[model samples]
Target chain A: MRITERQFVELIRKRAPSAGGGATVAGLRHGLRQGIGDDCAVLAHTRQRDLLVTTDLFLEGIHFRREWQEPASLGHKALARGQSDIAAMGGIPRYAFLSLGLPRRTGQRWINEFLAGFLRLAAASKVVLAGGDTGSSASGFLADVVILGDVPRNQAILRSGARPGDEIWVTGTLGTAALGLAVLQTGGKLRRSHAAFQAFCYPEPRLRMGRYLRQRKLASAMIDLSDGLSIDLARLCEASGVGARIVEASLPRLAQTPLRHALHGGEDLELLFTVPPERSPELPRRLGGVPFTRIGRITLERKLWLIRDSSKIPLPILGFQHF
Target chain B: MRITERQFVELIRKRAPSAGGGATVAGLRHGLRQGIGDDCAVLAHTRQRDLLVTTDLFLEGIHFRREWQEPASLGHKALARGQSDIAAMGGIPRYAFLSLGLPRRTGQRWINEFLAGFLRLAAASKVVLAGGDTGSSASGFLADVVILGDVPRNQAILRSGARPGDEIWVTGTLGTAALGLAVLQTGGKLRRSHAAFQAFCYPEPRLRMGRYLRQRKLASAMIDLSDGLSIDLARLCEASGVGARIVEASLPRLAQTPLRHALHGGEDLELLFTVPPERSPELPRRLGGVPFTRIGRITLERKLWLIRDSSKIPLPILGFQHF
Candidate 1:
């Protein structure tokens, strides 16, 4: 049937009478009271703490290729990507929901394997899968994960917290994922010595590190590097109403050749933040054995600059745009 | 750049650091406590409730066609479908996360309209959109909405509550959406007088009613109708380890044509329920002007029977399915 989106939606609404309570499902009425129509859905849990909500989509051809991904790995990556967002906000993830679009030709074995991978990660993180919807697709497989986390009433981190004079730091190594992508594209096998390859295959969420920063009241602002360093840093700076200047020698780059990969490579999933210079020394060089490095500082200049050797250069604004 | 899902997930894990003490983000961990490998993620909540989680996916061509829907309506319907599952368990929805995969050719205006419709419904429902990831696609649109809800300690209503001899009840009108679909498919223009058409266009959720059912201590078992009556009823019966028998004349049908539509049509969003005989009459026939009817009774026969003018016949199942 050639169902328009509207007709499909109407079909969904028709099921309501048996759904539950009238007042509870009256989304429009409740939405007005809670400010639900904005960019994100807001839920007030306490006087100072309100939950912020948002969602994203990743498609097979648009985000990755099936030929390159094992079904299990695809499932794992989907949840991790969403979890990173909660980590970015310095929130503790409590629950997750996954919606998958699979083709008829996809086997039940594939579905089970994917769920196994996803559920494994979710269990390790203490993230519970709450609920979701499922359907078939004729095009390709699609996975969407939604995550819920809690932030302290007054301490939920935001991208807009950076200020001029704040020193910037990053967790773990960067650019490995991008370089890994290069290796995968070239069909080059990973050498035993190439830790970057491993870094690319399994990007971890720095939930513990984020929580520490929020609890210690260390970072003035923070963001997780899902996009490459240049674009994500630019985004953090933009949200903070500030600029940044990074020293080449200060960055924690992978032990790989092309330095460009470290700078512009995406999917790093690392935490980037700013602290007062006085607090930088008090911060550990590593947290839970993950290396940390001071890479840059916030600036009032409102521009992103990179220092290579002794030459300062302007960084490009481009990042991975799905479109 | 091409990225494999395994490669992508590995990168995500590499970036995330192990849990650290007293940090906001670092403290939250992934992977199960029993060390991964589970169908559901177990989460520890503040109220001592163990949260169980799962996700499902819905896609365009596979689940519904764009030619039959409106963008806003599609968005709203997406959220509603997920919400129904939450309601099925009599849980209170707290958060929602959406991941959308749109074709590159899809315009921003369509996205805005979809979000407008979605947010409008989400706001009313008090479902906060937490965090999701987005990417582009080459084919159709995909929507995955994840929902988080909480049930009281040991108070969750499950599909396994019905008993033999429990009377079955349904809330609101049935077959309207299916009829609406038929009309739309037959190229029958919608007349202002056609409530079925409106029902097919816009759906309401019984969130309040579902909550009420739970709070009032009334139903023995409940489920929402997404896949037509026969299929969903069978599911409910399966879950409860029982069977059912519906009096054909007692089954509510839309005033329009085709008794088949009411019997096997999908997307009604109504609640199918079972209650003990004594409590059946005490239950109102309608809520908020939506009608209710006694359609069947749970039995131990392990079969579903349709009673037509004192004659018994086996009812065939017809509904949407992935396989």
Candidate 2:
């Protein structure tokens, strides 16, 4: 039957009689000061601390082809993908909610295997699977994970925190996931020295490293390496009202790989940050075994540039875009 | 390329750093008590009031057909569907997180319109849209909503609360949504008095009435009427370790429709509850304008019966089931 949005909404209102009880409680509407309408859900856990809550959808055929990946890997990667945003905000993940839209035909064994992979990772990170909803889908599988984390009332490290003098640093390697993607697409065999295949299938979230940077007051700004470094770096620069320049020799490229992959590839799930030169010295060279490298510095030119040998060239901002 | 669940999960662990400092200070570790290995995401909010969290996915072809619905109605219904579960638990909803997977080709207008409908209802109910992640899908639309709510440690209700000899009561009219569905399918006109069309499209959650019942010590057991009366009632009975018997004539069926709709139709979003006979007289015939009907009584027979006209027969348990 043809149903207009209004008619559908009216039907919902008819069903919802138990909403809005918080009007009776004072000071309870912090992050939700704007109420419920917006692109992102805002919440106030404390006066200065706003808890931002959001979920991401990863459908089997739509986001990944199941035939190429194992169930456990799919589950773990899904959670990591969501947590990357939390790391970008310099927040610590406290709770995770997973909603699975399973195809009825999928075997129970597949689900068990998937959970085995997800739970192992969750246990290691001390992330709780707080709650989730389940339903059956007609064809492809879908996983929507909602992660809840908190930042200090005013200390949230936003993409907008960088300044012209801030130095940029990236934790661990970059472009491995992207390179892994290329390898997978070309049906190439995995080389022992090149772990890009693993990087592609399962990307890690640098939660501890992010928290360390935030807690120690080291980073002026931070973002995770999900989209390619160039695009994501551009986003941080744009948010911070600045630009950036990178020394080609300073970048921590994956061993035995093309520099192009490291520059343009994505899904590294590493922490990228900017710090004042003075604070950069205080930052650790490694965080929880992940290597740290000083790649570049933020600049006022409002353009992203790459330096190689002696020539400085413009770095194109290219990465994944859903739209 | 090929990724195993184990390898995928390992990738997540490699990326996530250890939880430190503020994460420890906030006592956030308590949130992940379940450790993530189960079918459901386990969370313990309070020793006395443990929170059960779950999420559901609704896709275009999987949950509903786009040809039969408007974007606004779909949005509203989505929120209402999740809230109904909270109501069933006798809990007050505090926040909601939505993850939407839209087809890249879907118009921006559709997204805005959908959010407008969703937010309107959310605002009225004081349900804050806390946070969400967005991604583009290649095929149909997908929406996943995660809701958080609380119940008093001592007063929290569950489906397992009903007992033999408790009188069964249903709040509001039933079968309207089911009838509306039939109308949509048959292109049949609905009587002005029917109002089932609206009921089917938008089902109201009886949150206030639920709170009142809990606060006033009214119900011994309670559940929301999402599935059909027979099906939901049976569930309540099964959970409570009891059975029920209804005077078929006393069942609150909508005016001018098939009895089957009231008996077997779903998505009513009403409250099916039981109260001791001593408290029955104090219960109102209507709570906040919604009518209440005394439909049946809980019995020890371990069977559900419907009495119609002069004969009584066992009622068949039929309702929507995803599995």
Candidate 3:
């Protein structure tokens, strides 16, 4: 049987060498705090800071189609995916390494444009392009971007920190990117100014909001909504050993997007987090021009539930999976 | 026209944002020390150590063929390429991040064997597989391995450190991996015990030897022989703004391998370094069971020369290049 992405990750995690606690070298302590299951692997870096590392693969056909994506948007999205991981963990992105494989038919202008889009985002995020490898591809173009970020020691948010009474919250609207994907797939001619198009092609990572929540100790647990709300919420619940109950009417979504899209579509790139009931009062109604909407609450049960009107039903664990 | 790998790297370097000096965040300083042209990007990690980061792409058709390579060796070689880069800079590899894209036909047993080989090497070198990303590939299997290593502060031996009158040195015999590749290409049946076959499948990174040379401060400059003697030497010369002259008779190679393979074939994973004339007497003939051979000397003129039968001729920079 073909191995799913989740299975592959689990296999590696089980086989990986355990860096128990931290290794002491030259009287310095550097150990891994989080590994395979988190948005980013957290490692002890300096005396007061922890390093955050995340790797993402953007492949042609699997992740995007070249005919539909502008080279600039492709580059921007590529870096954004990794940056979002840092944002999810409440860290500051510092360095980025990009490994690119280009087919023989690729031209210089395309590469230049791709770099332009990538560097533009890097400058905005203050991430330096440190080093990477390039090779000739026999198939389609592929890019793997590795991002390194820094967070305050012992304060970086994690997916497993949620408690039972925490309220589930999301930043910005979900399903817009998925709606944009639908538009693209249907060969619809939409301008860059279109909301769905913009969301799908140039999703912005909520770095400032993530840092704000982290600094104030507002979020007990957090994860990025890259793979839609339903599945991502399931992941957070799984890690925290809690279930979640979502109010169908309370989810923030675009008017044009279907409820199913908001619940199951992937690549939204928003932040999904939980705040303790007592600390939820400290959260602002809006932070950095993005609205925070509470749509659910963490439960003691070990299964996901969706509340529509007065009835509660099971929420399917279907986001995006490559089997 | 297609951009060569050198041109692509130069382009990125020219356009990449400079991390001037080191940035201070929360009273700690971290910054990029070297980037792009080196084997690994050197970053100032802590007060006592520097961080070395390198990324490499191993594509199915470009770097290996699935039919010819065992899955386990593919995994080992993928990690070896990045580890070799760390060794080239005289650093100790700490963590590795792998981004693997597998085709639909990839079997679970193949993956298990691959991980087995990978973890075996990691256990040997004390390298930890901290994190990685996995995805489904629409084409061939591609793996991108990122290795992070540590070196003493300001102690990384870079290619640009070579000076005129420095004696050129190399560790181990060259071109064995290339010879192995030739055997594999010809469909020749060779046992794993065969030196050439072993070299092709399981080339070891010279970590201990590199640390020895770096700690002793014997080498003026260093680079790993990844892309053959002539081209990698040319790269070192270009980086140092110096020249090199090689004595054809002094090259250490297997008697069965062709002179052309010894000179221009790649993937030896050997250390090619330069030492000052005064320090030459302190160098050992052998360390860690690997032989050290003097093959040439750095030149005042900015060109490469090969001396044969007391007659000197220009050495062509015709090592492997993908465009």
DockQ of each: 0.28, 0.33, 0.67
Each model's TM-score, in the order given? 0.83, 0.84, 0.98
Interface RMSD per candidate (angstroms): 9.1, 7.5, 2.0
Best of the candidates, TM-score: 3
lDDT, candidate 3, A54-158, per-residue tens: 999999988899888789999999999999999999998989999999999898899998999899998898888998989999899999999988898878899
The per-model lDDT (C-alpha) reads 0.67, 0.70, 0.88
Let me know the DockQ for model 3. Answer: 0.67
Score residue A129 of candidate 1 by CA lDDT: 59
Clashing pairs in 3: none
Give per-residue CA lDDT, model 1, range A1-323, as digits (tens).
13333332343334221112113221211321122211223343333343444454557786777766567667777877767776776777765655566665777567767777787788788876554445566787776666756666546676778989999899988887788778776877776356656566556778888888888888888878877788788878877889999997877876673667667777888888889888878788788888878888899999999888889999776667665
Task: Candidate 1: list runs displaced more than 4 Å.
Answer: A1-56, A191-193, B1-56, B90-95, B123-133, B148-155
Regarding TM-score, does 1 or 2 come out ahead? Answer: 2
Interface RMSD of 1: 9.1
Per-residue alpha-carbon lDDT of candidate 3 for residues B80-173, written as tens digits (9 for 90 to 100): 9899999999999988898999998888999898888888898789888989998889999999998888898889999999999999999998
Off by over 4 Å in 2: A1-28, A32-42, A46-52, A151-154, A191-194, B1-26, B31-54, B151-154, B189-194, B300-303, B307-312
lDDT of 2 by residue, A74-150 (tens): 88888887777777667777777676777767776787777777766777777766556566766678888877666
- Tens-digit lDDT track of model 1 for B1-323: 23322333243344333322211222223322211111122333323232334344657776677777678878878877767766665666665556566676777578777877877787787665543445566788777766656554345566778999999888887888888878776777777367676666566766776777777767888888877889888878887899999988887876674778778888777888788898777787677887778888999999999999979999888766654
CAPRI band for model 1: acceptable
